[model samples]
Target: MTTNAAMQGKAMSVEEEKIQGGVQSLEVGLTVLDALTAHNAPMMLKELSEVLSMHPAKVHRYVVSLIRKGYAQQLTDGRYSLGERAHAFGVNALKRTDMLELSQRYIQDIQQHLNCSIHVSKWFADGAVVVQSLESNHVFNIITRVGSRMPLLKSATGRLHACFQPEHIIRPLLEKEWESSAKPEQYPANWEDFLELKAKILSQGYASVTGDMMAGINAISIPVFNFTQQLDHVITCIGTEDQLPEGQMQQAIDYVLGVQRQIDALFHPAAAI
Candidate 1:
């Protein structure tokens, strides 16, 4: 007694349901990966379950599958972190021809020249992320790791981005972060001071932070511009006060600038003017 129109409509509805059902498992798996990524560190099973608001048993099942697929790994302590496959994917992402592969040699050259920790950050929708890093041979251990998010109003790279990027693109993000802080007074004393700092960074073509994130540690950040003169990536040099001596500041700055010039020559040759 089913009419032809009713049969066609039922067929279409069934097809839509099937399509949605097909992706449900994949979507759940990705949700697990995303939660781990946001943590940026290894987490225990119960802790991860709490964060995801899922039952421990369910999370365990997903984690086991992820481990089998090499997307996640279980540490000796039974904590879970992103495994080899995930890191390999990140490395591959960084090595894309337009960015890391082209600049890697320069990064190495700068590291060898300064003998300090070097960080390369790329702008993301949320903020800057450390995509690559090189550790120096010195005993000083700078603990920054890849996938770490940069502070918008605090870190040297964050301030550099604020200076080079358009106000429309950067202001809202800054305001949101400011509002999130339980202590708003901790930010620049006033808006004028913040603007002034941005101006200074632009004029100097770099920004520096000393003992802000970590006591006795210091860092200098320089911007890289793409062919369109837009912000591309930021290079940050980090070390203790002794490692980055006051006398060597200019030399390091000059070397970093030279490297930026070389990158611009290749990536944005016509716009390098």
Candidate 2:
């Protein structure tokens, strides 16, 4: 129901606001890059200037800076595309932001809501290592410190990592830990039982431990998948039977699952599975 004059007025107002609030040269330079991005391919100077409604000389000036700063590349064929630095900037940005750092807020929320100790662990070359934690107010003495490395076959966090990891990556570490932990009997005598436990953890999207890693400690762990749809971090809720109780176990699992889903949705909506 709007007239052409009204739409013209709105467009002019937006342009006026942009010119008033933004640096003129920077805006023009960015617009040149924007045109290239929209085209999503190499473009000749005349084509770019025609699309942008600007003189070729002015477009060349902006493209020179873009190429110098590595935001855009001029190919040997005289066409342009996004430069290596532009692509690396995006990948490095994702790398610099740590998963545990983002999950800390969620961990604190879980602590406040459940009043149970929480541990955040990430997979390393060897195994899962605890990186952050919130102690339960009840405080029944937790021995696993932040730097503690969890057992692959025994601990909740380790089991969750093991469940999602390929066998080639986890098998050697498990064999090494199993040989050294001095708990030979604890390693399922039948290899199939271990496989079944892993299958169950993967199927349930979480794993539970009842005093396997540490005596009197019962914990549940859920994996957080990154944008690559690979398990990158694990969050474990820790408590004893006296604190978590048998009847409330599933409730705790449900809570941890909810937390994992929120993190997955927030950071990797497109990769969510």
lDDT of 1: 0.81
TM-score on alpha carbons, each prediction: 0.58, 0.66
Clashes of 2: 0
Model 2, 20-79: lDDT tens digits are 898888989889888987896789999999999999998999999999999999999998
> Which residue pairs collide in model 2, if any?
none
- TM-score (C-alpha) between model 2 and the true structure: 0.66
> Candidate 2: lDDT of 62?
94
Worst 10 residues of 2 by lDDT: 184-193
The residue ranges of model 2 lying beyond 4 angstroms of the native Cα positions read 1-23, 28-92, 180-187, 271-273
lDDT of 1 by residue, 192-244 (tens): 76798887888878888876656777788887765446777889998887887
